[model samples]
Target: MNRIQRVQKELERANADYLITGTTSNMYYLIGFSEEQMERPLLLFITRDDYFLLVPKLYEEQLKQFPLIVYRDGEDPYSKLNLKENSNVLIDDTTFSLFTIEILNRFKPGRIGRASRILGKLRQVKDDEELEKMEKGVKKAEQLILEFVSNIKENMTECQIERKLKSFLIEEAGNISFDPIVTSGPNSSMPHLRCSDKKVKRGEAIVIDYGIKHDGYSTDTTRVFSLGKPNDPLILEIVEIVKTANEEAEKHVREGMRAKEIDYFAREVITNKGYGDYFIHRTGHGIGIDVHEDPYISPDNDDVIEQNMVFTIEPGIYLPGKFGIRIEDEVVVKKGYGKTLNMLQKELYII
Candidate 1:
């Protein structure tokens, strides 16, 4: 009843006969319902004719808002499925584990295939309501980060700073989109390093990567800060290179560009500076209800750009045993432009 029309459209495009899923995000997008994940599987069945939700008796009260087919424990939930031989079934590979797969095998659908790509592509393009919420939530999120950066000082341990940062986000927003990344000195060289007890030294690169969950959307961005100008010129060099790569990619992205083109564009900038090997990870990823989704802007992807698709353009350079730098911004694809949602300075801040 919610975005069923979109699913219907997808059915037509995908040429599928039926759809089934148990993922929470897919449930939210397709039906405006988010089920609590449990050991007992919560199943959603969508056909050309109707929608059905099958869950254990315990969830019957919680699902009263929608039409559901409830079953008791130890009962054969498969008894309720309506399927025939040769019927194509689309399943969320991530959600439907082997346990769930075995249950579906009873239906004997002629074919079973991954349906995440179909849903992921559908989720890439945002409607006005989603865009409004994202913009407002991200603007407010930036202020909280500014507060963190302004108060940060030398000799603070990375874990302590992470705790304070998480505390601020938990106070302002109920959740984090992902675990925050806080690293300094040698640890900073690892792009995905989490917080540690290591003290943040002055005159070294410090990377802060984090995200916030607000208004049903997630905001992701990274900012690099320094207590004082590092004696190592390579750190500044890499930071400047990454900033330029971020800005260049954002400036040149458009509706017709291939997802890989953006990645290539950013990669070229880093490669020219001779730090290409040190720069790892994709240029960006589709972001919305889920922190990472479709339209991956990577060197290997072939997905084309379209207006209203929101994602990120993050570029970084990591020098092992030295330091690292990254500049990230959430961007929306427009007809002839890419609109970045974040307003934070990409330049390394000398805090």
Candidate 2:
């Protein structure tokens, strides 16, 4: 079913009169347009009987082409609605600003239902169109990674590498989903370390974790490489262990399986290698409009995996004061199995 049909069904089931918001993801999910709403709020007033999209007066001509959208000037959008009392309003917490929330509250005397988790649940399971967009995003990200590795040089500063990667992504007309992480030597141990001025030296491990956004969809990936020959046997050993863990997690991922089981699958491999403590974070998280979404893959989560859900299978072993190795790839859960979206090799590379 199409996204509009799915959302309509959910709205009927919840007995909501209308869904209001200015969130770009939800707007794109419902409508096809994902362009930035300049200065003006893009409120989607969805009801069982009608779908109205209110935008700034400046964008009236552009939005008017959309057959279903009922354009309204941003200065006074509510004037077009003429909302009735006792009507149920569904608001997305992520995109609803304080001023908008106050305006919505005035319409409904009682407390309104924040459709934060509900929208997340809907977005977690990708439809055919969303999956296709994400696949394109994955390919773009892979191409950018190849470009980055091919131009890598010895004795280059970590910041320089990050700048090169960012340049490549921008050149492809894609926005950075998040800040690129370029850590070398002992800095690799920090999972979320930002790029630094320190230059990468010979025989030092360089970790790069980054993502790109395409058509409102995101693709996340991580890879580690050394400037010269693998000097530390332990680094090689840990990289192999992480690769095994990541593959094992991907192998067991499928529909109807508990999210925690996937985490355990990877954790078992790391623990068996006597580096469980080094694997600090969760195995992965759901990837879609946001890099991190619902039904997180971790020991604490009990949500069952469903078909069309895409998430990362990243396993890492960080040895503080020494180095770290991490292998990550995005995957989508299939009916009876899972398919890895990233095609890059998992083996440690010597640049």
Candidate 3:
């Protein structure tokens, strides 16, 4: 179903009259527009009877393109017009600041709900268009990784690699989904390590994690490579274990499966290999307009897997003061199984 149909269905379920506020992701999902006035707060009022967009006076012309009610700041449209009371209003929790909340409460005090929580749950499952965009994103990210690894030189600092990756991604994809992670040697052991001036040495494993954005959709992926020759057999072994676990978990993923179960399937593989403790963080998380979404693949998540849901299946083992290896891939849940979006080779690369 299209986004409007999905949202109308949600309105029926909630028995809400209107949903208000201007969150970029939610607004893009509801109406096929990402206004340039995103820096200034805007409000999208969606009701069963009407659709209204409230923007700053400066964005009046842009709002006119859409066929809906437009409310500008300089004009007191609400006062001039009659707004029905007791109209169930859904507000974006993040966009509605404390001051805005007070104003909204004074004006429309009836049944107020939060759109962030509701829409978050709805966005967990990807539709055909969303999946297509994410697939493109993943392909671009994989290509960037390949290019980055091919040009890697000895004694290159972590910052140098990160800068190169960012430059390539911006030139090719327009923008990166998030900050690229580049760590070499012992620094790779930190899952969220920041890039530094530490130069990479021969026979050391370097971890590169990054994602690309296309049409507001994102795909996250990570890969580990060894410089020169393979200096640590344990690093290679861990990579293989994580890769196998990721593959095995994808096999069991289908509609109706619990998210936590998928995480356990991958975790069990690493545990059986006696490297469970080294594996930190969740197996993966839902990906879409935002890098992280709902229906996350973690021990604490109980959300069930559904058809059209897209997420990453990344498993890693980090041995502190040594090296870390992570293999990640984006997957789309289907009827019988999950389909991998990333085509990059999973075998440990020796650069």
Every candidate's lDDT: 0.83, 0.82, 0.80
Per-residue accuracy of model 3 over 1-351 as CA lDDT, tens digit each: 756566667887888876665656688777867653344456677766556675566667776775544555666545433456767767765563652564366567478778765688788877777778888778777777787688788898999989998898889888888889999999999999889999988888888999888888987898888777778787777778988998888788888889999999999999999989999989999889878877789988888888888888998898999988888888898876799887888887887
Candidate 1 per-residue lDDT, tens place, 243-334, comes to: 99998899989998899999998999999999899888999999998888888999999998999999999988888888888888999877
Query: For residues 153-261, could you state the per-residue lDDT of candidate 2 as single tens digits?
Result: 8777899989988888877845888888999899999999888888888888889999998888888999988877877888888889999999999999988999999
After superposition, the stretches of candidate 1 with alpha carbons farther than 4 Å from their true spots are: 96-99
The candidate 2 region of ten consecutive residues with least summed lDDT is 66-75
The CA root-mean-square deviation of candidate 1, after full C-alpha superposition on the true structure, stands at: 1.9
> CA shift at 291, candidate 3, in angstroms?
1.9
How does each model score on TM-score? 0.94, 0.88, 0.87
Candidate 1 lDDT at 170 equals: 78
Better of 1 and 3 by lDDT: 1
Count backbone overlaps in model 3.
Answer: 0
Q: Whole-model lDDT, candidate 3?
A: 0.80
Q: How accurate is candidate 1 locally (lDDT)?
A: 0.83
Best first by lDDT, ranked: 1, 2, 3
